[model samples]
Target chain A: MNPPILEIRHLDLQLGGFRLADFNLEVAGGECVALMGPSGCGKTTLLETICGLHRPAAGTIHLAGRDITHLPPGTRGIGLVPQDIALFPSLTVAEQLAFGPKLHRWPPGETRERVLSLAKALDLTSLLGRGLHGLSGGEARRVALGRALALRPRLLCLDEALSGLDETLHGEILAVIRDAIRREGVTALHVTHSSAEAAAIADRVVRMQARVPDAGERDLTANPPNGRWRHRSSGPPPGPEVGRC
Target chain B: MPSSPPAPSHPWRTRPELPFLLFLAAVLLGYLGLLVALVAANILTVSPAQALEVLRNPDIIHSIRLTFFTCTATAALSVLIATPIGYLLSRFRFPGRMLIDTLLDIPILLPPLVIGLSLLILFNRITPSSCCLVLGGTLALATLVGWLAVLPRSAPPAPAILTTLGLVSLTLLATAWFTRHSTASLETLAGDRFGLPMTFQPLGIVLAQLPVAAAFAIRTLRTTFDQISPRYEAVALTLGCNRGQAFTRVVLPLAGRGVLAAGTLAWARALGEFGPVLVFAGATRGRTEVLATSVFLEINIGNLPGAAAISLMMILLAVAVLLLVRLFAGNPPPSGQ
Candidate 1:
């Protein structure tokens, strides 16, 4: 059997006072896993660490069966769609989509074709010429997703993928996301707080608990049990059965 | 009750406040007019031809060249240095970050002459290499300590405090030991070591202007960096940009206008830097004499027309710079509230 597309073992990451320890997970090739946790849990941090933004204090991260623990984000072959939909304000949607491909030294024609295909997929065809500043939140999110998918990444990490949207729009975007992931055949690790979001697009679900207690909790100074809070599998994914639009 | 006849309109309630606004406007205009009138009076006393003649004077021309070039250099250097410093202050959260930020503002609040004097004293007492050594050592040590404190788990408070004190003492000792051999003043040392005159040299003028100019640049760029969302850089990173590429492609392009605006403001401030220049770089006939000191020299020598000509030149230059900055930066967007 092929090794998992993205594998993390015994990951320990600390940013400031917050600590995420002994994290272990694996996603098989082309699998979509939903990581749901409460606020202040290490969901975003783990996504970042996998993307090579944060260095793990301990443990190894493997992509395509190769250790990429010390690799820079640019070389990680992992695309990230952050919660804020951080579209580059200075670039048109077309330029934004082309950015990754161009950086990877793709030929002009190929880059343009890829950008156009992604734009079409994400319903960003009309807004390709528009700067990000004037985009509506929904449009911005779509463009951001398109940008992340432009490089045809081996792994895609989504932080709060269905957040800050109305319920109606959420279902629409999730359908688009599911279709795109299937088309690209990319492994995905989606982080969201909503259980419905987890059920809609994931083949499996996992949960991480906050290692540090919330502010004003009794055990402020006390270390977390066994140097980890929780890394429990929350059962199988429902796979887009939750009121698909 | 007939709604009390709809209530008679009070004068204050019905008024447009035009009179009050006009009064404030008059005060504002009067203050501006006072400056214009003074400059105008000076221009009036000197004919166009006389001003042209003053401009043609070799000494005055030299001063103008020195002023323009040094101020430009100061602005460029400051902006170059401030970009990374401002970025770090805006993006990173380390211990004593606030303290570093407050220290950046010291030159701005300091009297200009004091800034010059401080530089003068520093150069006089400490060799440049010595100064650099002490500063570099402290920074490297502090960063090492900071990293060790945070990473591998936070260190206990007692060791951290003791480590900080130890580093500080070591730095002080190093600085003192380095300065011990430098008995000669900056002027004498420069003449002996480099055979370049320190006082009244154009280089001294740049050194004097740097503190004030860099303070302004740092502050302006810090505000610019603060206004920029860090997520833009993050997006760039995830889009296959390394740190340098992310800054150059994403952050720099977004901040282009702010950088231009900050450079213009710093250049203007440096152009008008008089007190520091006077203290560090003395006013000589041709060398080290800038437009500000030229005006001072002319006034001292009872050359009213000459001073007036220089004043008019400065005003014209200031207006030109303002126009250029407006053209490039587009009014700076009212800064973040």
Candidate 2:
């Protein structure tokens, strides 16, 4: 059997006073895991760490059975859709979608094809030439998603990418994301507060709990724990499930 | 029927802060009125015919050309240096970061005469080797601080390179310092070997203008970089862009207006600089004289009308450049977008 697509072992991260210690997780190929946690619980931090935006204090991160702990973000084969939907303001929808492939030195023909397909899939064909300034929240979110997915990354991490949408639009974009992920066959780690969002798209929901440190703990002085795994909220445990959405 | 709330009163008449607002407006208008009066005086002192005659003077034309050339060079050089320093200040948090930031303000805060005197002393009295030693020491210290800050998170190979660079800089600094006694002053060396003496030369005018102009540019760019969110660069990195690519592709496009603003403001400031050019470059007609020094020379020779005319020209030129920048750049893009 193939090893898991993404794995973390004994991960320790310290950001200011907040920390995530002794953290462990594994995601098989083409699986989507939803991480639900309260604010200041290191959910975004964990996502950033996995994407190589932050270095771990102590741990190993393996992507497709290759050690990527010390790799730079550009070479990590990870894609991130940040909480703010950080679309490049200077770029048009088409340019934003093509950004990743262009940076990786893709041939113009293939890059154009990838951009056209992603724009079609994400319903951004009409808005491809429009700059980000005029994009609605939903449109911007789709652009961000398309930009990330354009590279066909091994792991896609979304931090609150679907917040602030009305119910109907939320459901529509959720379906779009689900379809895109399935089409690309990419592993995903999604951070969101909405359980309904988790239930609708994620194959497994993992709730993160804040773990306050004891006063005399040695690690507490160095790096206090902010959050740890509480339980699997739903879905089958550990192994990859067949036919995941 | 429910009782209606009290009807709103006239905003200007009923607002409690009206008096304070009026006072603020009065102060603002008073200052503006003073500036208007000064410009009027300069204009009224010189007729168009006299101003045209002064403008046609061969020496004055030379000053105009020299002023434009030197100020443009100063502003361009200012922006080039400020971009990297401003970005570093905005994005990183190394030891002595605050110190370095505060030190950058010294050029702007110091009296212009002092800057000129300092430059004069530096070029004329200090040996080239001693100057090199000082420059190298500062560079080595900065590199050491930066390397130490990144050591914890950087890859092993990067730290090795930084360490080696720091060591090399330090060694060069020590060697220069040991050999300082045998070296000639920078001014003498330039005059003897290169025929490019800095003091009392056209090059000295740019040197005098550079420090203050670059300081202002740095401040402008640092504020601009601060306003932009770092998340754009972070996302770019994850999308397969190295740090340099992320900065060029993501941050620079967003900072286009700020760069323009910094360059224009620096040029205007350089054009208006007077004391430093006077003290360092010596205002020789057709040689080291710039527009700012032209005004001083006109006054010294009792050409009051010529002085007024030149002053008005300077004011008009500065205003036109500023207006052009504002019209072209418009307002900065909304931060939210």
Candidate 3:
């Protein structure tokens, strides 16, 4: 059996005031995992840490079965589309799609072919030579996806990539993403606030809660504090901590 | 409240940009009033007979010709110097960049008299004014030693013009060659980099204005690029631009207007700079004399009518040049573009 492409073990990251602690995640190859958390909950931080844009205070990242916690983002073969879709200003659609592959010394003809196919799929065939400044939000998001997938990366970490899309375009984008993940078979970690997103595509769901103020070294003890909880089909209410997001 | 002054009603007060307009008006009136008063006084003093006499003076004609000739040459040289320097400062980061920026402002802020003295110190210090008696004293005043004590460009200059220009040209040629070689190697080893091509290099007069003009260019471009949503670049990168391709194609196009404005404004400033010309090149009548020197000498000689004529001419020329620049730089953009 082929192994899972990405594995995260108890990732812990602290940056000034915000902290992501007791973080554990795993995505089987060809699997899409949607990360959910409240505002200021470090969902994006977790993505950045995995993609090597940030560091986890304590964590282990295994990509394609090789540990890559300390590797630079460029060397890790992990592609990220930040929430803002950080594209370089001076490059065009086609050039944007080729950035990483060129960095890794991909052959020109193959890179060009890959870019063309990717462009065709993203409805960007007409937009290949066009500069990116004038594109609509939905169009920009699609281009971001194309660039990430162009490298044929083993892992794609998307951080709230649809924050600015309209409802109709959002559905179209979601569909495109589903088809893209299947066609590419890359392990994907998608962060969003919507549970509908997780239910739509995730093979398994893992819920994360923001660290509470003054909580010392993770309160792993179960049933220590008596708490009134709301029912969830006969389960206790997720209460303040778990359901807040 | 005793019958307020009808809320100071005017179309200007109610306009969306009214406050800014009023602020600009007050500043303009305050600073320009003295200059306007002086011009009015000169015009009042000019009689028809005196004006005709002033117009016929040969010395006045010579001074006017000399001043403009200097301004044009100096401006051309300044522009030649500023372009690459601006590009380098803006696009690259290296040691002493801040110091270079500060050094440039020295000429901009220093008084003309101090500038002249600085030039003297730079050149004549080595020649020891005693040697001025020999070598025809013409060579002494016409070149480095003269400007060293009296100019900004030559002051603190590391080498004389002869030595400096030849060395700078060689360095520029070598750099161009090196850049070409590296680009070729990179394309062979790692193809399709988007970094800017070497053909954009500035020349001659443009190079002379490299410091201030380039500084302005870099600031304009950097700010423009910064304001652009980098999300676009990231998206394009993900699409496939490789770092080089992404920037050239995506980011630069997005910032094209800003780049154009920066280039034009730098060119305009390079065209106007005067102090450096006077000290570095001297008022050698038609060689280094520019608009400011032409006006200065004519006014100082008590030839009010002649001075007014040339002053009006210089101002008109400046206006024409600025109009051409504005076609590219646009209406000052309210943000000093």
Best by lDDT: 2
How far off is residue A200 in model 1, in Å?
Answer: 4.0
For model 2, the stretches where C-alpha displacement exceeds 4 angstroms are A1-3, A213-245, B1-10, B138-168, B171-182, B191-195, B324-330, B333-337
Per-candidate interface DockQ score:
0.37, 0.60, 0.22
Question: Per-residue alpha-carbon lDDT of model 2 for B1-337, expressed as tens digits?
Answer: 9999876676666679789889999999999999999999999999999999999999999999999999999999999999988998888655566888899999999999999998899988898888778878887977877787777766333465567668878887987978778668888888888998889999999999999999999998898888888888889999988888888988998888888888998999999998888888889999999999999999999999999999999999999878966863576633433
Report model 3's TM-score to 2 decimal places: 0.59
DockQ of 3: 0.22
Question: What is candidate 1's CA lDDT for residue A187?
Answer: 89
- Tens digit per residue, CA lDDT, model 1, B24-120: 8899999999988987898798999889999899999999899989999998988998888887777766666787888999988988889777777
By DockQ, the better pick of 2 and 3 is 2
Per-residue lDDT of model 3, residues A1-245, tens digit only = 24668878777666545555556565667777676655555667677778765666676989988999977566677778788776654568887787767766889998899999999888899999988669877777788889888888898888887777788988888888777877887878888877766666555445555333344544422321221111111122132222211
Give the lDDT ranking, best first: 2, 1, 3
Candidate 2 CAPRI assessment class: medium
lDDT of 3 by residue, B129-210 (tens): 2222333333323344434532543322223433444454455445444554242332122213554221111111222333
**Residue B45 alpha-carbon offset, candidate 1, angstroms:** 7.7
Give every prediction's interface RMSD. Answer: 4.8, 2.1, 8.4
Backbone clashes per model, in order?
Answer: 1, 0, 82
Instruction: Tell me how far the alpha carbon of residue A187 in candidate 2 is from the true structure, in angstroms, after superposition.
Output: 1.1
